[model samples]
Target: MIRTLIFLASLFFINICSAEESKPVTLNVIKTSITVDGKKSEVYDIVQDNGQEGYEGVKGQNFDVLLKNKTNVPVAIHWHGLILPNNQDGVAYITQLPIPPGKSQHYFFPLVQSGTYWMHSHYKLFEQQLMSAPLIINNPNDLYPNYKSITVMLQDFSFTSPDKIFANLKKSSKEKMASMHMDHDMNMSEPDLNDVDYDAFLANRHTLSKPEIIQVSARQKIRLRVINASAATNFWVNTGKLEGALIAVDGNNIKPIKNHKFQVAIAQRLDILLSIPNKKGTYPILAQVEGTKKQTGILLVTPDTKIVLPSKLATSDAPALNDDQERQIHPLNSVVTKPVTKTLHYTLEGNMSDYVWTINKEIWPHVTPLKISKGDQVEMVYTNNSGMSHPMHLHGHVFQVTRIDGKPITNGPLHDTILVMPHSSKTIVFNADNPGIWPMHCHVLYHMEAGMMTTTNYTNYPAPSFYTKMISPQK
Candidate 1:
């Protein structure tokens, strides 16, 4: 009887593993229409066959991203914040080819980490068209059955085509230069913000006038995953009337910091946990546009609470985001120090006159590759000399912000993206355990499109056949 029971248990375990390996989540890439200001505008989305938005899965499981491209144009989806194999980093022409129209591509990998992450297009200007969604991988060990989980994705929308917007920026460079000269002559040093004025800011595809309402129970603990998927805008996430604790940033757990508001830059994600008030009331989690009065967010309402519409704009302008909040963040786990094996320095250089952004004064496709070796500890220091703030993101790795403005930080939080302010410097450190050429660039879409991207290539590493014929993005 004991022998039979052992054989049955082994068979059951094999069956469970087989089931996990066989089931793949299918994300259909299709063009859809969204209502904006009484008009219907076309947008792209990655959804399930049943029209379910985004994806959620368990950590420590085998999963596959079966992307089916139904749109006419080619698409490449980047799994932001996931540290997977280098060949799976989905930059078009760098790691792999774009998925052709009507074709499908499968990405199979192990879910090594769990937290709030996102997926979006790495193709040309597709991200600005709303081709993004939350990619949440829940930690199996976190058995928080009492908490309610919610995701809020913030975006900046424009009625104008992205191509036209790029053209306009190029055409108006001279006017921008003249304005910069005037400001300098007057001795003004305020950093510039909001390069492109968007038609609307959206929270989960809804404006403040018609915000997404999330029903909640009184005294319930809520875990909110907020993603800043905006092309260029930065926002201050305000937890109105309710105190919340920021538990994570960029999908990595950090020491809990209690705050009412936090700044989230483009491509950054924040995970906050808060409890609803015992008395029934409507509370808003608002994202105020940085440097402007515009706001967008969702409402958390209890049963029987009336929904009150919010104004599209705020009463006062929000100040530009700084690094004060970042300095307060520390990793949840004790950081283990490693000896530095390699150090790299880069200067974030650009000018408003030509609207051309570059790393170390060289643009993408022309920039020299930074060399690294596997198993080495790498330290990268970036000095932002330009007048614009940049959120730099590195693919296929999570890094720790070790220094800010030349000051050392003992145990900074780990992040895939870090925001660097104008004339400020930041230093990040990571281990080069994953060997492959990976792109690291500014998260601001226009800046990247204008040539602010470069790659870190491993010394003596072999490149895939497709990588040899790299397609240069138009400058």
Candidate 2:
């Protein structure tokens, strides 16, 4: 009788432990407004239970996301660059249904990897209004003891609606095409790329007019975690006059390489380490929008130094985007050479005249998914035949860049996003270890909205309930 009582007590204790392990960190998605550069615009931001806008989790903990939508419209959240389960991916209509107005949903997933990541709204154009924030997962054992870390989330803000901006772009593209035919000698060397003209560029939700100042000590080492959270803008990040080493890209550690400037496309992240100068002074770190003179920046100042904002800094031309910086990165831990079992070729086709984009001439929901078996090493080759560049992003996995335009790149670093130049091609290889349906699409928000999205599916896995319901005929 005593043994029976002891066994029952042990079972009760196990149940209590299980309950504790399953508890989730609550995150509320609410609408708020902040004035930036004299403009007050409404935004959707994710706030934690502590009433803070940002939150962090451990490497192996379960993050129970309670998405409480406060707005009148439906919303969904996508955890960018995270390798979670398929059902917890937070994609609207693909992974799960949208969280309705004044409702809540639970997103439970284990944090399988440790890195710098982010979460943003997956609804139409909601991400443009600053509905995103940093979701950092740290490694406790691998902490940098003496260095200070800072996160910079760069974005572009516009007062106009995204639908109207898209319409105007279509009209302008039609006019340009007609003019090109009439005037044969029109120099089309540098074609217009970006669609929308932003009212202001921001660094950490503030403009250069009132930039965020970082307090620093002379000769101290600083680690900057930079994320390009813009919906449709690319920037050239310049660490002005401070030589830094690029240590990681897209949350994966790389062989450190010294660089002064680097191109960060949409949805990309860069981890750079900087050594402050011994002489105390202020320094400006700038992110210049590609193909435009407008820019935004942040200042690092010592305790005794006075802040000096630079005038006419954005008028000067910034460097063009290229693969020179990408070629220098190599993964810290080398991936074992595996035999390729499958090869999928996708062509990125788009035209600004109609604002339509496609992958292999098909749009999402009508496109064929790239299928592979579990444990298969696959190669995805993206050929961009469009007039503009496309930063291709793959969810749920990091792939090594194997080739560029038919040339092999030795010891390429693992990346979640890689920029394919206009009329060029890029090749990446990854093992299909994570068994789930993953979206592989262009990082550009409008481009993906217009149609350039598809999925990678493991063979024979049943479609989730959300997807099955989406494809069912309306009653």
Candidate 3:
């Protein structure tokens, strides 16, 4: 009887293993070739969606990400606007080492937020092309009478490689990396690229005329996830044929705002839900950058055979608010928004020519730590002292972008990355729910390597098991 029991138990365990193996799975791996621009190029690196669970409720979609280069370069990838484990945030030399060229760095993080958010390289100009689609996690519980979802990713491209662009900016001598929050002259080169292989702006790898359109049915709720994936450009999203309701920002729920079109700064994400009012054969969702050309990602759905379009997108492109509106919107909200409080502040500062960046004007020492209690509501402000835009971000946390230039978010949306325009400012507020000392810095990777890097601490929280997975372990 004992022998029979053992045999049955072993047989049952094997069957369970077989069943588990049969379940659907996804994977991200390093590959050498991927299709881009209708041609198969020798991609430097590729990441397959190792279809590991990316977030809490996200259904698996294996993203075959295109990494630029002949091979993996020493790169770091941090989901700047995500709540993730410390080891996966992709902070280099501190959390992990750089992923070398001609190679691929595979990363997975729980996609807890369902709205709009993005991913980018944590190193130099790599974000220009190497950065792929913004991973959108949809709410499984959200049966909001909508069957269609659209993703619009915005990006900045140059005729020349980013390597050439940076080198040229450096040669100009007048071009300097300003303090992280300081102001600098915004005089940019005329965007017209000569000898450009890809002279087009893209909304999901396609230009406006040849737009990326998605089809939705009439009278159905269509959720559009807008991601400003650009390295430099800020965008204004135009909703055509669909008058949308602003439902959420940065994957966080907010009171819906009634608006037709809105401005989205670099690195920010907006989630808009719209009802396809009767009559839509084919229409386009366009993203036009101020003072530049436009790109389109299409949503082509049919309840009828009528082509629907708004008279003019700019008809609804309200001018950005002046100082008065800023004040009315972002009222002086309380700092350390805690029923119980723990206070901390680091003054973001920088120098142009020196290319030196600082927190409270001091470069962060690799040995020290940033401190905070778990579950504390943390607020950080970037006061612009120079004349340039800096997209400031925090790892392992997504904060509420509350104010711009001390004004509150009255009607405007919130985002993970708030572009601090030259000499102006923005303040972000959020709860530090996860416990880890995470890095906080500029999303412009080169600026970070220069000096604009720092960390925040959640006291008494040990590092994650993934950190133990580091190949070149530190003592």
TM-scores of the candidates in the order shown:
0.93, 0.91, 0.70
Give each model's whole-structure lDDT. Answer: 0.88, 0.82, 0.56
Backbone clash tally (model 2): 0
Error of 1 at 442 (Å): 0.4
Angstrom error at residue 70, model 2: 1.9
Q: Worst ten-residue run, lDDT, model 2?
A: 466-475
lDDT score of model 1? 0.88
Best by lDDT: 1
Predicted candidate 2 versus true structure: per-residue lDDT over 1-475, tens digit per residue? 9999999999999999999767766788888887887888887788887887765888878777777887788988899888888788888878888999989998778787666778888778788888888888787765454568788889888888777776776678788878878999997654566777888888888888889899999998988888899988889988988987888888888878887887888898988889998998998888998887778978889898878886425767765577887788898764436988899999999765566788888866676687888889999999999878888988888789988898999988788888888899999999888888788888888888888888888898777876655432212
- By TM-score, the candidates rank as 1, 2, 3
RMSD of each: 3.1, 4.7, 7.9
Better of 1 and 3 by lDDT: 1
Best by TM-score: 1
What is the TM-score (0 to 1) of candidate 2? Answer: 0.91
